[model samples]
Target: MNTRPPAARQIVIGVVLLVVVAMIAFLGSLASMPHTDGWYAVAAKVDWSPPNSVFGPAWSILYFLIAVAGWMIWRNGWRENQPNAAQKTLTIYTVQLALNAIWTPIFFAGYPLIGEPAWWIALVVIIALILCVIWLAVSAWKWSKPASLLMIPYVLWLVFASSLNAGVIALN
Candidate 1:
């Protein structure tokens, strides 16, 4: 038998796992973005563009903050008498993550890469929804400040990504 609160160490571990998964997903998505396509959009094929360099470090830091967000969610789950709030918030989280996961393959690894950018628009929707829910949860005291704060990078990235996607649609 074990004796531990529902929001005990398991929540922390889960948060860490979420962060690791976020980093891997971010890296994977990079493999398919515009600059990585090897078409030399702005420079030599092998050259490092500003976006790629900026993205790498920014995403690394984002991953750390995201983990903290997960922890906050877990703590919130513990405080609730039932799983209602946790389930809803986590469902939104899962939806966003799933959308995030699919973006790379569509934009980068898709067979023809023709319809890939549309997927990015969809990703934008997911990100927007996620931000809304996170804001609600934080405001309602269902989640911690750290969790909301951690997601700031993700929100920022999505805003940038939405613009990039539009540019891609226009250019390509």
Candidate 2:
């Protein structure tokens, strides 16, 4: 009895999802570049504007983890069997991704950017925290405590990012 589905299919799904998520995150990073090097970057330039080298690569790694985490949940026989939580989780994942992608434009491209990037930063923090909860539950669904454990750093990183965003807004 093939209790589990195909590992190959799950791996493929993981890869594709990772790529898509990375692309979206990268695009959002690019969209924010003009401001990063200009207004916000210049104004916030001191000893701590965040290392440019760290941002994109860090986000890419996070996206990859996200894809793997999602695939793990899917492979737990939840996507089809535990339809409700699975659906909610996936929907939250998409919403968080969309929110992550949109924050750049709102803070960078919009005229009268308003309270600076603080608002977008706060929103990202909230969304990321929600995702952490979702991912934790998704991991728990499979009785994989280690898997749920993996998302802790990610949640902490988001908290750090919120602080950085606040710092930037405060400086600039």
Q: What Cα-based lDDT does every candidate model obtain?
A: 0.56, 0.62
lDDT of 1: 0.56
Clashes of each: 0, 0
Please give, for residues 22-87, the per-residue lDDT of candidate 2 as tens digits.
Answer: 777878777777766676655564455468778878777777776666666555544343343445
Which window of 10 residues has the lowest lDDT sum in candidate 1? 40-49
Worst lDDT 10-window in candidate 2: 77-86
Using all chains and alpha carbons, the TM-scores for the candidates as numbered come to 0.66, 0.73
Predicted model with the maximum lDDT: 2
Off by over 4 Å in 1: 1-8, 19-23, 26-37, 40-49, 79-85, 111-141
Q: Estimate candidate 1's RMSD in Å.
A: 5.4
lDDT of 1 by residue, 1-172 (tens): 2123465567666767676667666666665565365642532322222456575677667656655565556556654344435656666655555555655555455424555444465555546645664554465255556676667667767666655544554454
Cand. 2 TM to true fold: 0.73
